[model samples]
Target: MLKKLFGLTASFAALVGLPAGAWAQTAKDADPAIWVVKDADTTIYLFGTVHVLKPGLSWFDEGVKAAFDKSDEVVLEMIEPDAATMQGVIIKAGLSMTGPGLSEKLPKESLPALAVAAKDLGMPESALERFEPWLAAMMSAMAPLSKYC
Candidate 1:
């Protein structure tokens, strides 16, 4: 089960267009483009909502709402993750991988940024060592989470 779970995690990482190692480190804020919309014709447009974040983040952006109001049926990005599904993904993936820890991943050289970001996120070094990579990995999968925050 653990092996399969790990493989599933890897598969999900790839499916989301991120590397497995992306789970192990803190990333800077980046524009969310996991979801996109483009015009198919003068009378039609397509909205692709990747089910990777909280809808509260960018789901109702002026442009997206305007596009929705302009259109008829809504085509979502693979059915969006409801609270339950999102919770399953979060639970299965976030706390699974930890033995390697953040200390090894962050290195003594990068301690300063780690310290600051850790404080901001309320993570202590030892506790974070157990959690950092897993949470980071999960975030990399859910690009929308960062967008929401």
Candidate 2:
């Protein structure tokens, strides 16, 4: 399973035109985890993902690449919204217009962590207060990953 996953990763890297030696280490040096579930008519491969990773970490190889090549479909969990539409949606759904702000709604103990995270993201705590809790949490989680991308 690991070998198959390596092949898939290698295939993706190769497809994207990365130089063979550009990665920090060869795929043989890495052992990424992969799992397969098979049923009567379908099979699923599951692998862990960090969503964003710094460049130069190589774990793709021929085995995984072969499995990837033979696969009929690939699924991804993301949606790309147009900038204006996305902004409108965020404003409509992610903002707290008249009620209590985020800090007021959050548990007292969580406020300090929220403040720290907001600061780390270079956002003022007040700015985060304008967001609904779910949006604020999502932003807090994703903001720190921007530097890696």
By TM-score, the best candidate is: 2
Clashing pairs in model 2, backbone N/Cα/C closer than 3 A: 4-64, 6-61, 7-64, 7-65, 8-64, 8-65, 10-60
**At residue 47, what lDDT does model 1 achieve?**
46
List ranges where model 2 is wrong by over 4 Å. 1-33, 59-63, 82-88
Estimate the overall C-alpha local distance difference test score of candidate 2: 0.59
Q: Estimate, for each residue in 1-149, the C-alpha lDDT of model 1 and write its tens digit.
A: 44534444444443454222233134433233334445666455554434344332334445655766887676544443554454466556566364666767766887776666555443354544544565654533443344432
In the predicted model 1, the residue pairs found to clash are 23-137
| Model 2, residue 8: C-alpha shift (Å) | 33
* Candidate 1 lDDT (Cα, 0 to 1): 0.48
Each candidate's lDDT (Cα)?
0.48, 0.59
